[model samples]
Target: MRKSRIARSGARRPAVATGAAAVAAALLAGGFTAVPAQAATGTDDPAKALHLGPKEKLVPQGTITDADGTVHTRYERTYDGLPVIGGDLVVQQTRDGRVQDVDKATEAPIKVPTTKAKVTPPAARRSAESLAPSAAGGGSPIVQDQAPRKVIWAAGGKPVLAYETVIGGTQPGGAPSELHVVTDATTGRKLADWQAVETGEGNSMYSGRVKVGSVKIGGQWVLRDQDRGNMQVFNMRGGLDEDSAPAFRNAKDVWGNGKPTIAQTAAVDAEYGAAVAWDFYKKVLHRNGIKGNGKAPKLYVHYDNNQANAFWLDSCFCMHYGDGLDNKTPVTSIDIAAHEMTHGVTSATAKLRYTNSESGGLNEATSDILGTAVEFYAKNPKNPGNYLIGEQVNLLGNGQPLRYMDRPSRDAEANRAEGWPPSADYWKPGIGKEDMHFSSGIGNHFFYLLAEGSGKKTINGVHYDSPTYDHKPVTGIGRDAAVKIWYKALTEHMTSTTDYHGARAATLKAARDLYGTKSKQYKAVQRAWDGVNVN
Candidate 1:
């Protein structure tokens, strides 16, 4: 047997690189010449350059006539304006075969054009004055025959676009929400009018863009408005948002045979888990939820065959569960659901890319931390949950759990026996898969210290405590403060390459930022990290 991988393997695992960037660079490398920064000027043609400031009051030039009196030429700037910082000029311009005439000019800004330039074929006429500040740069441009669409508002200030969206209504089959709010990047606040199109044919429908920002409902990056958010042609594949396949779905009737259906059972588990996560984050840690968007969550269950795995596909904006064993067992157990969904939370914030050794482990550890916190939140009797993974699944018929945070290596295959030494592999980058499932023990151990308050304490009938790498009996910060510190650290401070040590520093910094630098929470995080040998 493959020694039973972590039941919630997908929870908080680091993201894997699919080599997409390299492929894009390769494709664009051929026959590509860099466009010069500046362009030349011509008669009847106004000088154009990328401006670093706000909109300029320039009455653009019209088409140029040829010898036969037929119009043979037209031109427009690539963009209305460029980025501005302080009072520095950073505009790029191109010139065609026209007479350079600064003296004979149309209505343009007071700034002088740059000396350098490039020339191109005649094109469309432009009347736009100055470009807005928010419309600057992003991914590389695709220079094709057809130009992309541009939406501009005339308020020297940028405009926000609102929309009439129908979300999950009072009734399951009722009209969805009629109003959705998304801000225009150009305009910093909410939109004045709804701009999104009405989309979707049924319950599995919505309209908008899946973006990385705060949502009214509170989940991070689930969805936002189409405007301002980068429109990636590739995002529709598993994207979530106000305009995505509903992330939350009833997992009933998942099994075709209708054997031992746990639809409602699983639904209750998922809801309860989500509720616990929300409460734990709010009441305890002061966090909202995955990315702290404070948005109502969306979930999905009963995914694929009798798959024995559950995961939070961040791109999909939903939690997926597997029907275990003979299809009677739904992996929608509270811990499993909480564990998987936490991955979304982690990704939206820390986004610790799953590749690399310790990064994967950190990802898994994040799920473990939040999962345990949720279980502790529920405090159910029959379900009597704790920090152990897969205890409810009975995946291990012998009553042995998939992982024991108190002492992870006891699971046999984890290879994380107590007192293991930290090495370079633990710090490598892009070692996603291996670090997630196996090396997660380190993070698990840190959580045990933070939650249970380390040093020879027995948790739920298991007598255990992890000693620091220095073989010292380490103390812990109470679970309450630990959860908050970890959350703040992940969301506000940590980056994709952060690891155990980085996590420790981030938690300490977050604690300091949230509470006072000398507050108990900050000290607790510092002590906790020190106990784990991260200080």
Candidate 2:
């Protein structure tokens, strides 16, 4: 019934209007005049000019208050009471409300023809469900997670009325599925749908006898940490359905004996990884679980037999780990846990789509970058932090790391059948078009060069030989500053559709926000992008 309706509907998508500068200038002297200092200093306060229409509203997504009495608040805009995709922005100012700067996902106008949808809800769900497959074919049961909601599609160079639906299923692989589908409400055409399937830690196995968090439930110890957003780990034991899965329990609160075969071992790793990540965000980055709300999604381990990979799904708002090549090799490690969980962080902040070419690579790289930092922050001697991702798990089965930051090309996709190069040592045009795992090398290499500089060196018993695209020497700004700058750019500036070039601009803006525009730290960010050939 709805299938015939979908086939009949076809309309051209509207183009995004580009007049942000004219709007900004017009608002500079409007009744909502900025403070004297803001006007005198000529700060670009997009928030002051946010009154594009009365129906438009700015809802706060996050706020950062600094020790120097500066405030930065990120907001998501709603058009005609409908969520406006790609309509998020951040406003920064002094304590006295003197505007400093603003960052937005898009500068396009938000007006549309109307809020009514020609495509009915049932029609949209049918269209989205048609894209999903059977359970055996890597899809969920024929059940809608929720009713499809109307939204404004603005990321694809235009703003159009649409329907956003969450489909229930696993991707082609047996990972939890949260395939977000955006359907044109007028034409019934599918605009975009993303399944973040492509890609933790902890363990007594990897981190080695690490401290874990547990809570008492009905006088019995259950593997749940109340501090880190009440993160609870469930043992799948080669099953699905987390609601029925049992949580690892202990009478004395001693979780694992440090054995991979033991189910509790993976639980310990998951708990430890969550703790370290929570601590890392709070202490180093000054961030909480999601938007500082202290709410982390559930974590499920041993998801499927020989699952071999881990994934974060928006449907369950949870992270799932696999039993790896063999049942004995659970893929839970500190960096791995941090890596998967950072997917959650990226979703909550930048909302970077895992399907887009460039955004997907950045999404993966963001996880790798932050995951590496989490490992280094743990100070766990058994699992020392390094630029190499998944070194403890050794997924390659050759005692080699999954992906190398200092030298990404070292582990390119050897299987030409996969249709991607080994890896890229430096950024090149269309690098985003490469496999997200390998394309992520561009970001990884840039970060490595920025933190350690371009040269051969040894740290923590691991050797690194980082190079640059221009073959010029790029000075190290230290990982401490690099991580800070990256986290800032990700949370405050980046958008869902941000590409490599956009990343260059976002990080530079972040550096200017943190250190002065003239500071050496700012220069390091510019040089780092240049080293990656992003310029």
Candidate 3:
């Protein structure tokens, strides 16, 4: 029997690789073309380089200017006047407007038949309802109509014309489920179904008596932030519907008593978490907000009846948190909040698929990486920055962290003893059976090795003994440099379908861009991935 992998501590494990020459192939598949850092002579319009014609329209989304003066302009594509879901691409150019390279999600020619849907909206809704799992406790299921879009479903041989229908409703456990169901436009056959909600947990019990933002309206203080996009925290009061939850109110700006008994206390932690996350992104990453548009996502705390999970819903562009175990333990820690919110960042940028084994693992790991960076950025005394994830929640009864980045194998051993599947340390056969949370160990381990190096070391008073698959030791590049490389890789290099091998290439490219190709940081990134057996 395969060994069960378990995390050593924390309330819940954060749910969430490849080769060299083969790595180049994966990068090319993701639409990345690495060009040498040299100025192009011509004054070619970057937009014109897209070669968009009358049948195809390109809508400018955003522009990212790298440290090397390379400008990356992103665009959303439309073919035949219909929005293409995966038809987004980025045009890279020099400061002189000379085209450098282009990275796209799909290169398949969008040559589908008539955009008119043969299947009625009602028919698509019924087809979606038939596939949705029943809610727990026999609660009547509610489904919302999502705007249908013309998309190219390319999973099967050739890209085919499809109508994408989204069905959003409550799950059996009171968790929100947003199902993306794709149906053939002509045949009405269900092509694919993917859940949009990414579920995890956060326990407010860890962050004790943190300060929260509030505004005094009329006579009472409410959980509204005058700063940070005026993001407000709402109290579900054990309810499931977010639309009905009332905004948390207080007599004074000071909130929470460092105890779970008071719902307001959890609200304080949740708001503080949001504020910290917002500040981290803006101050460190230069991102204005989660969407990079100076907008804050609505935060809902105390959701459902002891839901014991937290999730980021792309449909609502909101973050929802659940109360764990008897509605007392609210999942609202600093790392958890940052982790869930980072999902939004991932969606906005790479839009990595949360279902594909390798891509899903990358998606989860991006959250962990950014979330950890947020913790260190905050540097709160109550929750000092550490390599351990979800340490404050104490989800395992024992005072252990959910997952140890310094030594992910520790969680694998715990998982094995607990009869859980083995964590994916180095990719092996049957790895798909491992939970995304477990497969994330490989990434967590890789980052740790990259930032802190391999072998025995103590960070923030915690001992870590990391190992390499080839029994080779690696030197550290410091977390600061490591984070910049990772952030650039995620935003500028990687795409939705990028897997482990692709990640290896992306980070290397990021490093080369930031520090010259022959820099120690670039070499360190290679060594770190090698330590994780990604080479």
Candidate 4:
């Protein structure tokens, strides 16, 4: 069956007769959608077991229309040992009052604040350079504040105490977004103060502090940290599910002009990529895991109709992958997953801005760097790790990879040319039309030079070398040193407005700070810039 996009409308309430009991009765009555008597019982199909016990009732009623135009009236019930309320237990019913697919809904539960995990080797916090408007005495001041203490519950876990805050909001010019501040209460140290866009989906969409904080906006409250688990998987056009779960349907051809289906081949690549990312954080960065909270990583696939893009939506706390339209293919490859998830780690740590050219490029490059690293780490047979982007999605249909990190201009849209001022190259304003993901080529190329270690290098039969702006050989930096430098620059020193030139300078300084100015890593930072053609 085809899934339908849900439409939301303004809400109305009914008049109630009286006291607590009457209020409870009225609330429950208003909660669920009215289901026909026949639909309340079992149907011939086992999947249509849609009934709620009298004692199990919590809501008065509610209903959601599924993709197929079928009405699913959901009610409070006990399914799988978990309490089902509100939109949590939906049952599809036909006009004739017969139930359709009635399985325990897997839409995750709302997170409660609670945790025992201590903040691991804490990360350094860097102040954001004041937005121009704020400095000019225009918008709200974007200030860095410490996280506050509060209680929260981790998904599938008990409540725990944690720290959180709204670091900066509505810069002096009143920028449309706010920077959420999160940290470890026990240590009372800042962890991350990052930007977040409101989803407009009401408090329920976001699991924790945002909801509570919204209750008393102008006033302050201690925010409790809720652990958003790592590893989110979605049933896209083609996805796998347990035997008893409802298989996603109405598979369509989004990319490759072929029906989207989970091939064993693609599955192997995804699994390997996810595993490698998990390991990289554990081994290389010594991160407890994604989000530094030791939670399982999450993977979401098959998003949007004929959509050819992927992004990490900070509001949702998960990575999203999309099947390409006519011009692109499904981006459910392993490297893609690793790349998207790394954005989350960055958000939880550095919180890089997606706007402006340099930050935009860094956003894309971070994913690419880690994506390639994860690929190399996995060494999958179907998709051998390489410095290529979207190799498996086959968007080009000619079996060519998308975006060459060593030379981002390969895509035409990903113009990697530098030397232009930030506005000329960075702020095109449209979302990805010619924005962050595309202009990111410059930084991506820079990273490739930094990683592959300054020169023409070939892997798995693909050969390429770094080029300078004047079409000459740019030289500087070793791969190992470049990684260290960039990572330090990103997590320790760089800010949202930091541009490519700023990045070069910051990494140079970070190298000197981490290793003496005469060290190999220090020189590597300089060489990496030379190799990327950056003066």
Per-candidate TM-scores read: 0.50, 0.85, 0.84, 0.49
Error of 2 at 481 (Å): 0.9
Q: What is the model-wide C-alpha lDDT for candidate 3?
A: 0.70
State the lDDT of candidate 1 residue by residue for 1-535, as single tens digits: 0111211111122122122232223222211122222322332223333231333322221222222332211121212332110111111122334332211111223332331112111111011101111111111111112221222221112221111111111101111111111223332332222101111010000111111212234432322222222111111112212243343222331212222343433333444455556666667665555444454445544433344555554433555444554445655555666676677665554446443245557777787778778877767654555667666455535655666776665666432342223221122233333435556766777767666655576665656755555555545656776777677566545554565766776676667656778876666666555655565
* Best prediction by lDDT: 2
Better of 1 and 2 by lDDT: 2
On residues 194-293, what C-alpha lDDT tens digit does candidate 2 reach at each position? 6544463211236777777788888899988887888889988887667667888888888777777578988887778878988998899877674466
Which regions of candidate 3 fall more than 4 Å away from where they truly are? 1-54, 113-124, 134-143, 146-148, 155-157, 171-173, 186-190, 413-420, 428-434
Provide the overall lDDT of each model, using Cα atoms, as 2-decimal numbers. 0.41, 0.71, 0.70, 0.44
Lowest lDDT sum, 10 consecutive residues, model 2, at 1-10
Error of 1 at 408 (Å): 2.2
Which of candidates 2 and 3 is the stronger one according to lDDT?
Answer: 2
> Residue 69 deviation, candidate 3, in Å?
3.4
Deviation in Å, model 1, residue 33 alpha carbon: 39
The runs of at least 3 residues in candidate 4 whose Cα sits more than 4 Å from the true structure, single-residue gaps closed, are 1-232, 236-272, 326-329, 413-434, 453-455, 470-478, 531-535
- Which of candidates 1 and 3 reaches a greater TM-score? 3
Output the worst ten-in-a-row residue range by lDDT, candidate 4: 199-208
